[model samples]
Target: MIRKSFYMLWGTQTVSNIADIVYTLSLVTLVFTQSGSLLTTIFIPLFRMLSKMISGLVAPLIMSRLRLTSILMGSQLGQFVIFTGLIFYLWLSPEVSYPIIFLAVFGMSFLDGWTDPARNALIPRLAEDEGLMKANGLMSVSDQVVKCSGWALSGVIVAVIGAIPTMWIASVSYFLAMFFTAFIRDPYAAAGVQAADKVSSAASGAGDVARKPSYGEQLSEGWKILATNRRIRTLAIVDNIDTLGGAAWLGAFILAFVVEVLHQDASWWGFMNTVFFIGSIAGGVFIVARVKKLQKNAYLWMLFSLLAYVIITFFFAFNNVPMLALILFAVSGLPVQIAGIIRRTLIQQNLTPAETPSAMSALSVLSNFTFAIAMLLLSWIADRYGMRDMYVVAGVMTTAAVVIGFVYRSAFREESSPAYASEENVAVNKA
Candidate 1:
């Protein structure tokens, strides 16, 4: 079951990333061909935010309906259709308006947001408790590796042919992903006895006899659990801080640097993203071994990583040298690696299976809110105050998170009972 889950997830991740990378490059080319305004670039992130906001509201509902394997395979099939339709519309029909393309792509982005949480929530069902963190780290590492590799590969595809062929590669990747996902035997029995009972018996494809958990009731219960769960609630805040700090480096501030600092061609943008992603992949591997360590002292590592990121942000803002900033960005990339591993594993550990999807949605919404607001606020500060000085604001706010952490330390150390600690994690696997 574990082996099957790993292969299945790898397939989905690789295809999804290929689809993303190709779509991104294609859209940039299309926008340039149509209207070359710098502002048009904002459409990529705008659709992204629309997707996140929508997921905050709807992802749980969508997650609840389909079994994890179906949800994953279905997502790929959806991508294949969406990417194919966009290619035909843009390259095939010149008369179609760009807004039509944007709307179609935006709807696709909204659907794409469903993939992450649903996939993450499915891991615990595949691996045991001790293995959970490793599972998450492996997935995170694979995502970065695939995303970066896809970005590198897309350039060759784009150069050899054009955006249209590149998108075709992406479209095909999604379909191949669907093929791979067909191998995953379902691992999850639904949560709560009442809601899960209605699901087809093992005579059907589902792994075990599952109790049907009420979607509405399970979701509501998750909120109640979250309300009482200080560890999760506190870590969620720390996760937001981590995202906000990284956003300074990834979002507006990075853009500000290219225009104001590097003074290089805008084409380097994707390449720069690839560089940090490579760093993140490197960090991801080291984190797999450390994930269990994090499980032991989850709060401390969480706060420690946040502190590292905060300090890295301060360095990023004032540094005059591009090389120095890039190095710091690599280091800044570490927290994102560790915190993400810790956060997802902890969420899964803490939440009941039924509540997992809604809990993820709730966290996704809050984290996305902080990221968007930070991006906007940082942009405003760079415009009005001074680009370098915003680091001071970032530093101050980030430092405050430590104080919050100090007060919340007890909650973060909540002990896991024996039942959740399964033998699969501790047992030696030959793979």
Candidate 2:
């Protein structure tokens, strides 16, 4: 039954992911064709990303009141309704206003933001500790596969059908996503029962009413968890620093590197992006295949990945040869992807099911917020010091993460206490 629930959750997100890509492509095409302004088209993604960041910031408030499955289902249903309305507005209005289109986009994106943390939080509950690594690996592989092909497929889709029809496809997809989300069983019932038992025990005391935590306290829950938990805090710090450094791979910087350093044309830029995704997919496959062996040394695997990132990124900064750069780019994706899966698994193992949603929400906000700032910082570095220097800076930042990971190495190690350990992570103390 748990396995079935996991698959349902998986299917729900997969369908929604395809819809999101298709919808974005269609919306971009619609905006460009209507306004014929590059800046206007650019604002679509800008608005969507910013709204998601805002949503992530506020998701904890809703998570406190709603189950993860409810949040997931509601988010998808909201997206469906908004997209359907947007489609209708576009069809009815002979001239659609950019503001109206962007408003609808923002609404949908705001709702969409809750889905990720909810999905991630739900995974451990459905899969349990024994299956957590495989669950994460499966999700990672599906995500990479969708990302690897979604854009290209959606591009072709938008090209064939008009933007409106393509959007209708997305609307239908969103509805189906919501449908699948509805079937996901609540995995927190056992936790709820445990809480009830505690409440009853407390109520047995005369004239003792347990005070519920205040809203402010609940709002700060995830942040408090990160602040108080050294293991999770260390991981969060490394994750954010990695995110900042990883911004070197932003399209603008990569395009600059391809043109100026590799001396390749725009097509090669596209090829490099494609190869990056392919490498990530391959990395996911590698991890999934070796899950049992790798699970025992998850922390070590993460350290290895960071070391690989430090080396590959530094070499990648200097290489003028396009072929060698391609090889380096492809190889670089492996460790990073592996590290991502392992890191996520470790965090899942370390947190209780109830804490996962809020923690994931907090992490999501930090990551998106960091990426936004990193883009600006990396862009400046690329402009002032040249693109090669930008990547070198990236390497330097990741090197700090490696140093910190080594310093806090014990935090990720296996513990005899199952309270902080999972079956797969039990042997990671060898790190």
Candidate 3:
């Protein structure tokens, strides 16, 4: 069985995920309703992403000073307080400025940015090494569940009761998430985490005192670690490129593909989305059930999964039959799900427990930044060149990642040594 703390973490994440969807939908509806400006509604997500990128850039500093559980709880509490105030203002105000709502969205997302890195860091503390894949699989499944069910449910709740009441429900969800976060324990304390810093400082001498690192050092710590570690550096590059390529699957791009390529109506777009999500959930289940066999060859599993993406994506790029397109899309999620769960497990396994937050934070920054670029760049490609060219460009990017993965295949060996301190790992971590 997974530990109680993992369950607690899962519960906290699940509620927060639900709250996020509900809150975003309500905010978007309210902004468009009140302002009647599409640009105003667009700014809500733009501001949220910008704030998260900023938060991610500074996350290492906050993480360096606090325990993972403390960071998680504090972030959740901060978001809850800000969101509650925003909801109250929305309820009372006859006329609210766009900036007011954007500010609240920014504040909440900034707090939320710290949650993922902290949570990923904490999972290693809660789960045993052997069960790490299972733990990650469970987390992935919950995320997919929230995406599938939470969106549908929140949509209905908002349409029926209106945005204000929906915000109230989201507020309650955030409060519950904060309550659950309070109960999560980090079994591993600072001993492992702080040792690296202390060791580096100890070289100062017996009589001399070592100066503490500045906040700037703390902020860059993750980047330093990422640069020093060869396997992780390679993985980071691949993951970011993959994210850029994956932007083709975004809702806007998919809707366009459905309408222009498949020659289907809007209802087929929804059908394709539902099928894709269902496939993801099914894939997560398949992984959980067979994690033991899969974990052993995780590197190969990841490679094969990306290969599946290459095949499915190329087929998806040219295929005109909506029914065939649906089948390929559904099948596509299986490999994607497997790759994601294993990749996360591998990263956690490679990093020292204490190093995880910084690495995850650094990675989160790259991911969010790449996604933003990919969204705009690929959308333009789709509109200017054609959907076919857009998907082909995406496939080419994924193919580049695959080539990198193959060239560095030895670095991903399951039996390879865990990531050593930079000097040792750079020379020795290769399988």
Candidate 4:
């Protein structure tokens, strides 16, 4: 039953992610074609990121009161409505305004911020501890596969059918995703009902009313958990630091590197992204095949993965050869993918079902907010110092994050021991 639920959710998410990529591609092409302004084109991503930041700030409070399934379904429904509206507007109107496009993009992204964390939280509930690594690996593989396919197809789709038709296709994808997600059964729903009953009984017997937590209090709980919990706090810090420099991979920067540094045409930019996704897919396959072994040495693998990415990225910054840069970029994806899988698996393992939603929400907030700021900062640095210099700085920041990980390695170290599983189970049951 759990496996079935997971697969269903996974399938829906994959479709949704692919649709999102296509939608983004279509919107960007439409904006650029109409406006003929690079600044206007860039605002698409900025608005998306800003929406994520806003949604992340409020998702914890929303999740505190809503069922995870409800949040997932509602978010998808919201996207469906927005995309459907855009499709009609584009079809009828001679020209769509930039502000209207931005508004629609922001709406979709805002819902996405809630949906992403909710999906992350839902995974642990649908998979056993022993299968957590495998589940995450499968998710990573599916994600990369969708990304590769979506990106490859988006340009073709927009070219062949035009951006307006592509938006209609994306809308249909969201509609299907919403239909599928509606079928997911929340495993904790029964437990939640019983818990609520118990609280009510206790209140009645004591002749006292139990007050629901205020929205501010609910929001604070997520922060408190991150601030007080060593493992979560450490992971969040490391991830945020990594993201600070990770913006070097943004499409514009990568295109600059390919064209200016490698002296290559635009096709190579697509090729570069393809190889990275291929590397990530390979890494996912490796994890799925060696889940037990990787879980036993999860932290060690995580540290090695971070170091490998740093080394490869640093080397990648200097290489003028296109082939070598491609190889380096491909190689760099492996450790980063592995590190991400291990980090997510460990975080899920440590948190109880009750705590997962808020923790993941907080983490998403931190990650999205930091990445948005970093992109703005890094874009300036890239303009001033060159894309190669920007890549070098990213590598340096990633190395610094790895150093911090090593210094606080004990938090991750617990995952490697047998007793950690038992302790984690006890914590979950207590919650």
Candidate 5:
């Protein structure tokens, strides 16, 4: 039963991810063709990032009051409705307005913020501790598969069927995602309802003295937990630092490297991306096959993964041969994929089910903010210095951060928590 539920959730998420890629590609193509304005085309990503930031900030409060299943299903339904409306509007008017496009993107991205955290939190509830690593590895594999296939296919689909028709198809994907999400069994739903009933009973008995937490207080709780917990705090800092350096892999920097250093055209850029995704898929498969062995020393695996990424990236920066560069790029993807799987599994293992939602949301907020700032700073540095120089800097900084993380490895030592233990026992019994 547990395995069945997990597969259902995974399938739903896979469909949704593919839809997202197609939708974004179609929208970008439409905007650039109609407006012929680079600024308008760029604003799409900016709007998405901003909307995600806002939604991440508020997700904890919403999750606290609602079932994860409801949040997941509602988010998918919301996207379906938005895309359906947009398709109808285009069918009627057929004029692509920048403001309207931005608004649509904002709505879709805002809802996406809730979907990710909710899904991450739900995984622990559905899988036992012994199986958590395998589950996470499977998720990573699915994500990489979707990214490679969706990105590669979206361009062709848009060109052949047109962006408007592609949007309609994406809406159907969302509808299917919503339909599948409805079947997921959230074990926490009963407990949450009971807790809410107890709260209401206490409130009535106490005659107005028992007040629910305000939105501001609820919002701050996630951040407070992250700040006060030594293990969580240390992990958050390390991950953010890593993300700061990893932002150098953005398209602008990659394009610069290809054009300036490799003396290659846009086709090489696409090929390099394909190679990286293929490498990521290979890494995911390797981790999934070794999930049991890796779970015993997840932190050590994380450290090794980081070291491997740093070494490969350093070499990649200096290599000029196009074929060698392609191989290096493909090899560089493995460590990051392994590191991501271990990190996510470790986080889920450390936090209690009740705390997982807020903790993941806080982490999401930090990641998005740090990535945005890093992209801006790195883009400026790349503009002044060469892209190769920026890659070297990124590799060095990431290595330094990983070394610092190892120095504080004691913080990651697992401590017995009754909440987590109880949740684990429940999951094991269910399995």
Candidate 6:
């Protein structure tokens, strides 16, 4: 099952991520060609942010209706159609209409959100125990390879050939992905099984999945779980801290720093981004390898996260030297990757399947909400102080994580949690 699922997942992700990279690079190139405004360039990513929330909401419904394999294949097929339609729209388009193109991109992003979780959930469906983390790591590995290779190559293609062919290449990749997905069976294919399980759980009062939820119920339940569940809330907060501490701010700061501090071109965005990317690649692999080893000191992963952010904050704060700052930022990637996998694996494995999507979504919603709020605050600080000064504020927020981790370290290290223990083994496995 692992072998079959591995091939299926690899094919599914490789093509999908590659297609996305092409589309994005193409879109930016198209916008720059058409409008010649950096704001339009920025809005592309901003609008697509909606897709994350969309994915969080869609994951449960997609999983509920279709099996994991079916969901995976269906998503790939939808991407194919979306890209084809986008091409048609472009062909029909006399001018580059931002709204229509944005819609196409947003629509694709909407599907992307659900695609990831469903694909992720399928890991446990395919393999369990120690292998679960390994499977996720492999998925990340494929994702990184595609993301890196596609973005790098697409740039050259867009420069030489133009955005139109890039979009076509993207569309073709989706179809190929769809073809690969079609070959695999949904490991959790039977909606009937899920339905029956829901019924059984509801009957036994295990946990209800059948009752229709009001939007408020969905919203409130999200908070209730996070607030009351010590482990869940703590991890979510730490994760949120990591994201909110600097991601949205980093791009601007790094860009400014590379030019002003490093005395490099405005073009160093690619190099800086690649540095971060390389860090993530290394970090993701480390997570897969080290998650089990850190089972006892899982809280230490949060420390790693805090340390990374603090380093990032400090790296950017007073530094006029771009190369050193870039190096520090690259070094920061390891902990961020470690913290990400640790948090995701713990959350997904701990929650029941029914709760998985909501919990994941809820956590993400918080991350988004906080980042937006922090962006405004950081912008204000940048206005009042300077870009580098914002790092000081972020540095403080980053260190807060260390304090939070110490507070919740006990919860993270709870081997009694169902995730860390098999039903057959109730005793904590202290190595």
lDDT of 5 by residue, 241-317 (tens): 88888998877788889999999998999988888988998888888789768877778889889899999888888
Predicted structure 4: lDDT: 0.83
**Which residue window of length 10 is worst by lDDT in model 6?**
422-431
Give lDDT tens digits, candidate 3, residues 116-206: 9998887766776456778888888889989988878888888899999999988899899988988897876666555656644764656
Question: How much RMSD separates candidate 6 from the native structure?
Answer: 4.1
Tens digit per residue, CA lDDT, model 1, 69-156: 7777777787788878888876778574768777867877777777777776677767665677778778888888877787677777
Q: Over the stretch 1-431, how does candidate 4's per-residue lDDT look in tens digits?
A: 13678888888899899889989999999999988999999899889988998998899877877898899899999999988988888889987778888999999999999988898888877877557788888999999999988887898989998988888888989988988898888887665445445544564666566556567866776777688767777778888999998878877788999999999999999889999999999999989898878877787788789899988988999999999999988887788889998888877776656667787888988888788788888889889998889899999999999999999887654424231233345243221
Candidate 3, residue 410: how far the Cα is off, in Å? 1.7
Q: Lowest lDDT 10-mer window, candidate 2?
A: 422-431
**Model 6 Cα lDDT, one tens digit per residue, 279-348:** 8788878867775686555567658766766877686678877777678777777666666666666665
lDDT for each of the candidates?
0.68, 0.83, 0.83, 0.83, 0.82, 0.69
Native-referenced Cα lDDT, model 5: 0.82
Higher-TM-score candidate of 1 and 5: 5
The runs of at least 3 residues in candidate 6 whose Cα sits more than 4 Å from the true structure, single-residue gaps closed, are: 1-3, 184-224, 416-431
Q: List residue ranges in candidate 1 displaced over 4 A.
A: 1-3, 190-225, 258-275, 417-431
Off by over 4 Å in 4: 192-209, 414-431
Question: Which candidate do you rate higher for lDDT, 3 or 5?
Answer: 3
The parts of candidate 2 lying over 4 Å away from their true place are: 190-207, 414-431
Candidate 4 vs 5: which has more TM-score? 5
Clashing pairs in 4: none
| Arranged by TM-score, best first | 3, 2, 5, 4, 6, 1
Clashes of each: 6, 0, 0, 0, 0, 0
Model 4, residue 105: distance off in Å is: 1.6
Q: How many clashes in candidate 4? A: 0
Q: How many backbone clashes does candidate 1 have?
A: 6
Give candidate 6's TM-score: 0.85
* lDDT of model 3 at position 214: 74
